[model samples]
Target: METDGGERSISGSSYKRQDEKFKSVRRVFRIMDLVSERGEDLTAKQLAREIGTNLSSCYYLLGLLVDEGYIERVSQGGGYRIGPALPSLHQGKPRSDFDARIEPAVKELAHRTQRHAYAAVLWDGEVVVTQVKSPPRSPPVGVVKGFHGASHALALGKVLLASQGAEFVDGYIDDYGLEAFTPRTIVRPAELHAQLNKVRMVGVGADFEEFARNLCCVAAPIYSASGKVEGAIGLSTTTRRIRDEGQRMTSTVQRAAAEASTLLSDEPDIKDGKNRKSG
Candidate 1:
C-alpha cells in the first residue's frame, strides 16, 4: 500500500510538471502569433498583458524567441516583428499574390511620371514600403521595399496615417514620437493633425522637402471595398520638378491609386479599429 501511494504521488508530480511545460510552449506560440499579426507593433509590456504573464517571464520568452530567430527587434523602435526563421518554417513564397498584382500599377506610375514610384501600407503600427518602381536610368530616391519609419515626413506614409483617423494617429504619435527629419517636417502634433484633415478632404498627401531636402513626393490613398484605406501609391522626385508639376503629379497618383483600389476591392477588412472616428 505504501509503495502504491508513493508511485501515485510521483505520477501526480510528473503530470503537473508536464502540464506546466505544455502551458509554456503554448505561451511561446501565442507570442509568435501576436508578433506575426501585429508586425513590429507590440512591446514587451503589451505582449505580457496580452498573454497574461508577468513581465519578467515575458521578457525571458521574448529573449529565447529572439535568440531562435522567431522574432526580432525593430530597427528603429521598441517592438518585435516576425523574424526570417518564421517564414523559412513554411515552404511558401514570401511575397503575397496581391503584392505581385500591385507591381504593374506601380511600374506604370513610374513610367508615366518618369520618377520613382512606390506603394506603402500601414502594417499594424509601421508604414512599410511594399513595392518600388523606378524609371530606367532614374537615380535612387531613398525609398525601397521593406523601408519603414518616419511616417511624419513621407507622402505615402501621410496618406496612410490620415486614413486611420485622429485617434489612431494619436496612438501612433504616442508610440513613435514625431522626429523631425528636416526643417520642413511637421513636428507639431496639432499642425500634423490639421494637415491630415486636409488630406482626408482632398484625397491626396504631399511631402515638400519634409523627409529630405530637394526631394518631394505626392501620394493618394488606396481604399478597400469596404472603404477602408488599405495602402497608398506615390511618386518621388526633385523638389523643383514637383514644384513645376505638382498638379499633374497629384492627379496621376490619384488615378493610379484609384485603379489599384478597384483591383483590391475584395481584400479583407482591416481589423483593430482602422478608420476609427476622428477626435
Candidate 2:
C-alpha cells in the first residue's frame, strides 16, 4: 500500500544492508592498496601488522582479495606473498589473448572474481600461463603472463597431467622420478600416482609447500575440443590463506577451467585455435 502522504521512505534494514556491502568492498580495496605499495610478497601476519589490524582480519581480507584477484598469494617465508596476474603489466600477449576465443571469459573471471586469474596450456611438459588478469588493486600491478614452469613441481603441472589421462601421468612420473624440490615435495612415483588419481576424481590438484617452500597452489585442467588435456589455470598463494580457502578457491578455479574447456569445444576451429600455430 502506498503511503497516504505519497512520500518516499526506505526501510532501515535495506539501507544498512547496502551500507555493509559498501564498507566491505571499501575495506577490501584498502587492503589491496597496502599490498600493491609494498611491492613484495607479504605474509598475512605482516600485512595485518602493517595495516594496524588483527591477523584474523587481515587473513579474512586476504581471502576476499584472493577470491576477487585484487591481490595474488605466493609462497614466502613459510607463508604467502604477492604474485603477478596474467593481465598485469601486459607481459604476455597470449595471456591477454588466451587463444582469442577464451579471452572474454578469462577476463570476465578475473573481473568478476577479482583474483589473479589466468589460463595455462601445457607446452612441451611445461605449464604456460597463457592469459592472466592482475585485477584492479587499489594500486594495480598490470598483468602477469607467460609464466611457465616445470609440470612436475607445480599445481599447474598436476592439473595438466591429470587432464592428460592416467597414462600420461604414469609416464611422466616414470620419466621425472618425482624429484623433490623442498622436503615437502613428493618424491615417490607411487605417491604421485595416488595424488593424480585424486586430482582426476576431483578434477583439480593442489600443491602444499611441495614445489616452493611456502607457496600453496591450486589448479584445474583445460580440455581440448576432443576433451583431451590442453592446459590448466591456477594460483600460488601462502599455505596460511590456503588452509581455509583452498577447497573453495580450487572449486572456483575448477569450474572456470572446466567451462573454458567446454567453451573451447563449442568454438569454430579457427576462432579458438590452439595455443600455438602449427607450421
Candidate 3:
C-alpha cells in the first residue's frame, strides 16, 4: 500500500506540472485578447487589478507574452500593448508584400557580406525565418524561409529576443528552459542576460558556433517607423569566415538593415513585386 501511494504521489506531481503549464498558456492568451480589445497600454498592476490576480503573477504572464512578441512595451504610453505578433498591417497582405519588398535587399546584403542573409520575426514564442538570400555557391549553414525554432539559440532569435527587454527574457527562459544545441550554446541565465545586454547596447546580436558546431551568425534589428523592433535581419557563414571578417560583416549587415528599414517606412504602398522600389 505504501509503494502504491508513493507512485500515485509522483504521478500527481507530474500531472500538476502539466496542469500549471496549460493554465499559464491559457492565461497568456486571455491577457493578449484583453490588451487587443483595450487597444492601448496597460500597466502590469492595472492588468492584475482588472483580472483579479496578484501583481507578481501578472508580471510573469505579461513577461512571457512580451518575450514571445505577443505584447510589447508602449514607447510613449508607458505601459504594455499588444505587440506586432497580434493583428496588424504586417499580419495580413502586408506580410507577403513586405517579404517581396525586402527580398532584393536581403540578396544584396548577402552579396555584399559574402554570406547567407535572412530576415525573421517572432511568432508564437519562436523565431520564424520569413526570407533568405544565399550566396552564389550557398553559405555553409543558414536558416531557410519558414524555419522555426527556439529563439534563444539563433542569431536572428537573439536579436528579436533582446528587443523585448530583460524581464521578458527572464520569463522566456523560465517558460522554455534553454536547450544546449552545441557545447557553445548559452545555457546559463546570467550569461544570456549579459549577452543580450551587449546586443541591446550595440544593436547587433551574434552566435559564434553556438547553435551549430561550425556555423556562426550576426544579426541586426529592423525597426518600425514608431521605433519599435519589427523583426531582425541576419547573415550566416562559416565560423572561420566570421572570425576572419566579423567586423566587416557586422558593418555591412547593419548598413543593409538600416537601408531596408528606411525603405519599409518610405515605401508603404509599393507592395507587389512589380512596384518594388530600390533601397
Candidate 4:
C-alpha cells in the first residue's frame, strides 16, 4: 500500500506540472490573438489588463516574445505589434482577401494616373505598403517594402492617420515623435492637426517634398464595410510633374480608393462615428 501511494503521489505531481504548462501555452496564444485582432500594438500594461495577468508575468512574456521576434517593441515607433516573423508563418496560406479586392483598383489607378500607385495599411502606427502598381514606363519605386514612420510627412500616412481620429493621433505623436523629414514636413502638433483637418475635409491628403526632396504624392482613405478607415491608396510622382497634374491626380486616386472601400466588410467612419457615404 505504501509503494502504491508513493507512485500515485508522483504521478499527481507530474500531472500538475503538465497542466501548468498547458495554461502558459494558452496564455501566450491569447496575447498574440488579441494584439493581432486589434490591428494595432498594445503596451505591456494594457496587454496585461486585457489578458488578466499580473504586470510582472506579462512583461516577462512580452519580452520573451520580442526577443524571439514574435512581437515587436514600438517604444519610439508606436507599441507592441506582431513581429515580422509572424508573417512567414502564413506564407503557405493563400492570398489575403484584402489583396484580392484592392489589387485590381490599385492597378487601375496606376494605369489611369500614368504613375505609381500603392495600397498601404496603418500597422502599429506606421504606414506599411501592402501592394503596388506602376505604369509600365515608370521606373521601379523603392519605397514599397518598408514602413513609413513620419505620418505627417507622407500623403498615404497622413490620410491613414487623419482617419483614426484625435485620440489615436495623439498616441501616434507620442509613439513616433514628429521630426522634420524635410523642411516641408509638419513637425508642430498644432500645424499637423490643421493639416490632418484638411485631409479629412478634402477626403485626400497631399505631400509635396515633405518626406523627401523632389517627391510628391496624394492619397485617399479606404474604408472598411463598417466605415472605419482600413487603409489608403496613393499615387506618386516627381514633385515637378505632379504639380502640373495635381487636380487630376487627386481625382484618380480618390476614385480608386472609393472603389476599394466597397470591398471591405465594414464601413464605420471614425470621424462622425457613423457610416457615411463613400463619396
Candidate 5:
C-alpha cells in the first residue's frame, strides 16, 4: 500500500508539471497572435493584461521571443511587432532579391561619395539595414547590417517612416516616446512631424548630428515597381564634410536610389527570361 501511494504521488506531480508547461506555451502563442492582430501597437503592459499573466512573466516571455527573433520592440519603451524570423520560417527563403539588387548601388554610392553608404528597409515595422559599403580609408560611422531601432534619429529611418503616413507616425511616437539620442535629436512630436512632412515634400531626409555628435547622413527613398516606397539608400560622413558638400552628396545619393529603383523594377523581366531559358 505504501509503495502504491508513493507511485501515485509522483504521477500526480508529473501531470501537474506537464499542465503548467502547456499553459505557458499557450500563453506565448496568444501573445504572438495579439501582436499580429494589433500590428506594432501592443505594449508589454497591455500584453500582460490581455494574456492574464503577471507583468514579470509577460516580460520574460517577450524577452525569449525577442532573443529568438520571433518578435521585436518598435523602440526602447515601445510596442511590439512581428519579427523577421517568423516570416522566414513560413516561406523558407533567404533575403529578398531586391536587397541583393540594392547592394551594388550602395557600393557605387560609397565609392562616389567617399563615405559609408547603406541601404535600409522597413521590415515588420522596424527599420532594418539591409546592406552597407564603406569607401577605402573612410572612418567608421557606427552603423552596420541588421542594425535597427532609433528610426526617428536616422535619415534612412525617417525616409521609411515618412512613407508610412501620419497615423502610423503618431502611433509610433505614442508607443516609442521619442528617445533623445543627442541634443540635436528631435524629441518633440510637433517638430518631428514637421520634419517628416518636409521629408515627404523634398524627397530627401537628412540627419545632422541627430544620432551622434559629429556624424551626419542623407537619404533618398527607393521605390518599387508598384510605385511604393520600398527602401532607402543613404551616405554617412563627418559633420564638416556634410556641411561642405551636402548638396553634391544629396544629389549623388538620390541618383543612386533612383538607379536602384530602376533595377528593382526590371527584376521581374530578368527573372522571367531566366525561367524561359530554364524551360
Candidate 6:
C-alpha cells in the first residue's frame, strides 16, 4: 500500500495537507515583503510585477491579506500601505526596534551638542515630527508638534524647501505669506531662494532665531533609499549654547543626517505617519 520511503503513506492525504499549508505560508511571506518594499501604494498590477506573478494571482493573494487585516485598505493618504496587522507581522514583536535605532543616534547627537535632537518628515506639504529626543539639562523652546515650523525660515524648513526645488518653494512662500516670526526671519522671496541655494550646496541649514529669538536651530536633510529627501533631522539649542556647543554639532549632525538617509533606506515602507490608504 505504501512505497519503501514511507513518504507514500504521509504524502497521500496527509502530505497534500502539509504541502498546501507550506505553500500558503510561502505566499504570505511574499506578500509581506512586497508591501514593505513599496511603501507608497500599489495596485494589484503593480504588486504582480513586484512579486513576479500573474495579475490574477496577485489579486487573490492581496484579497486574502486584506481580508485577514494584514494590510488595511486606506481610503486616503496614498494607498495600500502596510496595514495595522504589521505588529503581528513578526508575531507581535516589540514596537521599539526602529525607534530604538533612531534613539541612540539622536541621543548621541543631543548629548554631544547640548541641544534638542529632532526628526521631521514632510507629509502632504507639512512637516511632521516623527522623532524627538532631548539632551540632559537642555532648556525647552516648545517646538515639537507637527508643522511647528515656517517653511521659509527654519533650518529644517529651508532644507525641505531647497530639496523640493526653487519654483515650488517660491510659489509656496508667495501663497502662504511668510509669518516673519522674528526679526531674523527671511521674508523676502528672492532672499529665501538664495538661502535655499546655499542650503542645497552646503548640505546643512541654520535657523538663526528665525522662528524664535534667542533660539537657534541647525538641521540636515534625511534621504530615503530612493534618494528622495524624505525628511530632515537636526538639533535646536539656545543662542548662548549654540555659540559655544553648536559648532561642534555641525559635523556630527551632518554625519548623523547622512546616516539617517541610510537608516530610512533600510526601512523603506514603515515609517510613522507615512502610511498609505486603500479604497
- Model 6 residue 165 CA deviation (Å) reads 0.1
lDDT, candidate 3, residue 75? 52
Summed backbone clashes in each candidate are 0, 23, 0, 12, 0, 3
Model 2 C-alpha lDDT per residue in residues 1-279, reported as the tens digit of each score? 346799767788989999877766776666767665553556677777766668887778888667654456653354432343423322344333335766665676667656666677665444556666656762332224544445667777787766666666666655446778788887777787788889889888888888776677787877767656656766555678788778778777877787777767864332222232222
As a TM-score, model 5 comes out at: 0.65
Candidates 4 and 5 compared by TM-score, better number: 5
Task: Quantify all predictions' global Cα lDDT against the true fold.
Answer: 0.79, 0.64, 0.74, 0.74, 0.79, 0.67
* lDDT by residue (tens digit), candidate 3, 1-279: 247556534477788999888877777777877776662557777788776678999888888877866676765576765554443244566765566666677889988866788998765455767777777886335654555566888988899888888877877777678999999999999999999999999999989888887788889998656676777888887876777889987898898789778767754543221111122
- List runs of model 5 lying over 4 Å from the truth: 1-95, 267-279
Name the runs in model 6 displaced over 4 angstroms. 1-101, 269-279
Q: How much is 220 displaced in model 1, in angstroms?
A: 0.4
lDDT of 3: 0.74
- Give a tens-digit lDDT track for model 6, residues 42-61: 76677677667788877788
Report the CA-based lDDT of candidate 6 relative to the real structure. Answer: 0.67
C-alpha RMSD for every candidate: 8.2, 16.6, 17.5, 9.6, 10.0, 12.6
RMSD of 3: 17.5
lDDT agreement of model 4 with the native: 0.74
Stretches off by above 4 angstroms in model 3 are: 1-90, 267-279
The C-alpha TM-scores of every prediction are 0.65, 0.55, 0.62, 0.62, 0.65, 0.58
C-alpha lDDT (0 to 100) for residue 249 of candidate 1: 94
Question: TM-score of model 6 relative to the true fold?
Answer: 0.58
lDDT of 1 by residue, 1-279 (tens): 247557534477788999988988999989988987784778899999998899999999999998976677875568887654443343223224445656788889999878889988766555667788888986667565656678879999899899878987898888778999999999999999999999999999999999899989999988777887867899888877877899999999999998888777766654432222244
lDDT of 4 by residue, 134-214 (tens): 889677753543344567788998998898787778777877778888899888998888999999998999999998888
